[model samples]
Target: MRSYKAKSVTSIQLPPRERRETVLTEAGHNVFNLAADDVFIDLLTDSGTGAMSDDQWAAVVRGDEAYAGSRSFKRFRETVADVMGFDRVVPTHQGRGAENVLFGALLDDGDVVLNNTHFDTTRAHVTNQGAIAADCPAETDLTTDTVGTFAGNFSTDRGWDAVEEHGQDAVSAVVLTITNNSAAGQPVSMANIRETAAFATEIDATFVIDACRFAENAQFIKQRDPEYADTPLSEIAREQLRPADAITMSGKKDALANIGGFTAVRDAALFEQCKQRAILYEGFPTYGGLAGRDLEAMATGLREAVQPPYVAERIEQVATLGDLLRDRDIPIVTPTGGHAVYIDAAALFPDIPADQYPGQRLVCELYREGGVRTVELGSFAFPGTNRPELVRLALPRRTYWHEHLEHIAETAARVRDRRDEYSGLEIVWEPPMEELRHFSAELEPVA
Candidate 1:
């Protein structure tokens, strides 16, 4: 089973930094505002932070940089088409850029979009375009105690219900985010996908897949379900893509590149409209706000990502971190997600009141104590009292090793030792009616 070694052909060491008395401040109460050197192990997110392979670097060097009809864009477009099963490729700077182009082309005011769980950007973009976003998680009987195998499934009945309630004329799309990020990185069942596709067709609604983490989702399907135990990762992924009329993808995650994304579609009209929008906002359809080399790197990375060992090892590394935290009796999202381990912040900081922002405290403390930087997925991101509170530790691909995670595990145990001591944080400044405010929301430890 082991045919090749993955040792990095490069050396790494700690970058120089000026020791600071504290990582927090009146200005930088949030971890997002922290200086890069202050964070020793940055698990803030997996997006656009992964290490590109040597082969990708080679591709980057050999890329064509023409302003129009670039050969690099052609290569990138062909690769995504072959791997993702889309005939038309419209590149964008990142996932959100793709979303902006696609949503701008497809959705209008008063249109309703359904998602299993909408991540922050997805929801913001929907409402930004004057559309309504509704979440329909798999289980109507959702409980916090037990974690289901496919917690990411979209309810088949709910999709039909949305179409019926709003009238098919008002329903724009049904989106399934692979390894649903908002609900923790859980995989959707193939059965669920097929069922949803049928519902979309019945209502004449577009089935748009948010495939940012498509490869990892496929690996989980093989590992969790016996029916696909022997299927190739890429083919299983293709099956997931089969019923989709359109897709929004982030080259930042599974593509193993620094930055780039694309919107691909089978609907010819939508394809042309998306291209028009991409040009207006992003750039020429060829570059689409990306350097030609970035597109080339994405082309190679997408191909390398599906190879068995690469993805298998990638998910395995994340599980190892989750396992470490579990062995310490720390609570986490069960069946650790493909990309990250989520800490149950509510349980971790029970002493801190919800209004005081306990999750924010945990996030800053990790940075202040162990130089570990992570992001809060609950109140800070959602700004809701009813939403589940979570601290996400998203590992970048090929960027970190076990020793780094071991240090993080030990650091988390240190934080857990004083979890009771954290009084919590309270926002002192927030933007007026901002759709997204976590980036600039100023907070202070509750006095």
Candidate 2:
């Protein structure tokens, strides 16, 4: 491994373009170089097309006819029915939009929702209801407590008891985030899912699945479990969905070739209620607040999402990055359960205190040092911003290559070697200045 000099005192500033070599030397490649000009591998965001054919775009343009009347809505309904096997489907603009509508419609004041864990936006919506969201597994559950935090661990008697005490009426819904994001992209076992669904049934609580990464989750289940290994990807998807009453999907993550989302209900009446609310918050039921192009792409994207080989290829690429990082001992999340690798910055930068949080420190250091930007998923990955720190590296839909991963491995090893003097700054909330909104504050390191 190569070692580099650390400056005892230096201003934390972007290196001048004229000092471009210094920037590359300090941080490697620009990690956040998705500037529409860089072909440098993109693994920071979840906004890539899965190489959809031009014909699909054409179909979206033709959507005016088949999706015009109630008959068109029926045709769109058939698409959801075919993909998820749910007869009642209500499309939404994107993943969070769908979540907002779903939570707004079902959650009332003083209600509570339980999740394996939650995404940042989801927690915001739950809190927006004047309701609180709680998780059964503690922070240590993902590390050194694998058995206690296994995906199916939701089947534990204690978990069931907690839900029971909350009472079905008090508990608005039980949400299962597929490919459990916070747990190092871990997947939920089928047995656990079925068991939890059964428990939800016993309590008459609605079962909701945040299926943003369903394709990736399904592929993991198929590869790890032998009995399910031979199952067709589509069949496996349907089986996983069978336990839920409603599903919210982000077409951007895996369904649509572009940005869009859908919220589908199993019960016709529930779907109608969701739509009535949609008209107010979103748009009309027919388009579900999405543009006609989005409606068209989502319908076709849902179909392509089920193709097994396509799903497998993406999963394989992610696993490859995991292998690379682990080989370098860069402290990345092992087993690479889902599609992203979470680098444990706390372990990488042990000198940084918890209050300052290494995850936040490393994010600032990486960008200022190398111009490569990644997300701070440790505390930010969760709600409330009070938890173990993490540096999250999301493998965008089809971005990056073997060489890119190699460069990442090299860069991470270098960062790990000189983390002693890096000082991270505190988070400060600010209004988002662009279309891509961030969680909490846009943090920077103290020079």
Candidate 3:
């Protein structure tokens, strides 16, 4: 149920370039043999469920052993362990599911979760558990004080303040998002993560990494840091991950080829307890609601996720998009970390009132005009109402190439030119169609 308001909006009628039509697949309609140069990138969706190698399919086709009897759980456990060096691993259906099971299991009433910034789902999970999610203003001091919005935002001092104000018992954990999505795809340096993790440990609280884009974060760090110039990407990621007591990953983005998520913990007791909750919400402790196929793809994807070339390629593509957007003075979060291009709508559309946040305005306008869809990162995603607005353009994982970027850039240029026209009405949304979910914004888009 979407709410709609009758407002005249600008329209862009450019024909989207077509790349490839099809790729052979046993799953038929379920998979798209996406050419590397497709124009319409699916940013609003998850990583596609493309078909995997014949051997991968065979592994999935043989599920029983993969799930329980054979050291399937152990193998997956060791996979997580070898990389993260965590004592135990507990697989779940997806990242949010892992968040739900883990938070629900750990948080009681009045606990607090502190993070540099938060993803929508993570905040909702904390709130749902009757816990408070607080942000410690972090600033990424890459250079001097001229800190970028995305960087230097995760500060250790603020984290200390949070725990000092709210006693250790009141603070359940400090969760760090690798590529802090809400903060414009900005990644925390290994130094920041380590300091934050150390601070959390000092307060006797659990440290968790929302490692949805761990590999991307690793690339950003390596490219940005001189000290890490010689270190391998895998080693850097493992080091950042080592400080956290547990990690929650979205398989769709970084681990599995398709959709799924898993959580791992270093403490034996915590791992056992989290696994027990997984049985309740997820599936059995062994498989945890994933199909045989998903488990197999995930196994392969996890291995590929750490490969330097695989990680580097995706980061490069996203960086390309970011560079293009920035070149046009489109108000993008420059020095883009990895994975996405974040447009600072407020800066771009300064005249638009905060009450009618221009970012939301642009999102609606772009969709109506070019049939391009994107998620709005604004107050709606935050716990409290009236937060700053931002528009996030999540690059489709390993999809599209130079030509696809041209279309996106063309669309953006058109949108920029027509920004004034869309700003005319200053359309303010009425009550939302859906109750405020975390990151998702369902609004009334009327013509």
Candidate 4:
């Protein structure tokens, strides 16, 4: 394997223990509220937190800043069409922006959008438009210990149950999230993608994909799916997306770019509708709320992301982290996932109840112990949804090396040693928006 070396470095410092305690208290025990300077290793999210490649930076200088019909936009559109097999592409500032535009145009009141599992922002966008966001994850998805090749597959049984209750016409679109983030970052098999597309077709609903980690998903398929073992990564990616009528992508993930995303569609009419909504909510069709330089970088990054070496290395790095934690008896999602290692918070702190926010408490302790920040995906994030309590340690693309992974594992082990000393948290204040309250909600240790 060829090692990719970093050409630039940035300095970061870990604040003292007393300072971390003070900052954690002042920030209402939320890692999101902490300043960047006070943190040592930031694992809050992989979204736009990666280190862009030198080639991507070079493309940035070559960007054409024209307001309309820019050269950068042409390259970006061409890349999407060639790689994703979608001719109609509309740029967006990020993945959620693409979701907002596509959902705004396609969905209506009382409509339903089904998925394998909807991430935080994706579900919020659907419900915000007065539509129902229904998730139909496979049974194995919830069982963190069960090892499966494609645990991210959508459950047709559950989906059919939803259809029977709501009627076929109520389902506006069936969206499949590749490498399902909400399900321990599990990968959706190519077979499942085709099955999902067929389900959408039978119900006369559009088939869409939330393809934030399309490349990572394809890499998994190549490694696990026997029929595609000899297929190239780029070809596997195209096949993975071929069943979709449209796709919403987050360039921050697989694309390896700092910013930029797009909505690509097979239908011309739907493309036009998405473009109009993009204009209303984002910006001009050419740039969509982002600079031309960002479009150029995204175009370059998209091509770079699917290369065999890059995709293999990215998945291997994540597996290494999971292995380190597992060796220490840390309860993580079995078989590991593509991008992040999900620690089973409930198992780690059996004494802490779900309603009391065990995931959030673990999140606070990880930071307080080693200045390593992560996010909780549990009752706090989902509120009344009753989702499993898991703490996600998302590793950014090419940002941290083996040493960093070791440090993260050590920090987790340290917390596990003193797990009994920790307690749960209670939400003291939160925003009015129920689905989006986790971002800014304030919490404290339960009395």
The most accurate candidate by TM-score is 4
- Give me the candidate number with maximum lDDT: 4
lDDT of 1 by residue, 298-400 (tens): 9998998888898898888888998898888777887777898888888888888777777788888777667788998888878753567788899988887
Model 2 TM-score on a 0 to 1 scale: 0.84
TM-score of each: 0.94, 0.84, 0.83, 0.99
lDDT of 4 by residue, 125-195 (tens): 99999999999999884545766889999999999999998999999999999999999999999999999
Residue pairs clashing in model 1 are: none
List residue ranges in candidate 1 displaced over 4 A: 1-21, 140-146
Estimate candidate 1's alpha-carbon lDDT, on a 0 to 1 scale.
0.84
Q: Model 3 over residues 364-445: C-alpha lDDT tens digits?
A: 5554445455656764445254445667777765555577676676667778887767552222233342224422323332
Greater TM-score among 1 and 3 belongs to 1
Worst 10 residues of 3 by lDDT: 23-32
Question: Once model 1 is optimally superposed onto the true structure by TM-score, how far is the C-alpha of residue 130 displaced, in angstroms?
Answer: 0.5
User: What tens-digit string does per-residue lDDT give for candidate 2 at 1-447?
Assistant: 111122232233334444543443333232332242222333455644444445457766676633334444555678778878788777777788888878887888988788777667777788877887776543333431232323523433655666667765787788888877766677887777888788778777788988877777777778877879888988888888888999988878777467777788877778778888888877777777666666677677777777876677777777787778778777765566666777778778877766655776676555544544576666534535455566777776544457666766776776777877677555444344211224434544545
For candidate 1, give the lDDT of residue 70. 98
lDDT per model, in order? 0.84, 0.66, 0.67, 0.91
Better of 3 and 4 by TM-score: 4
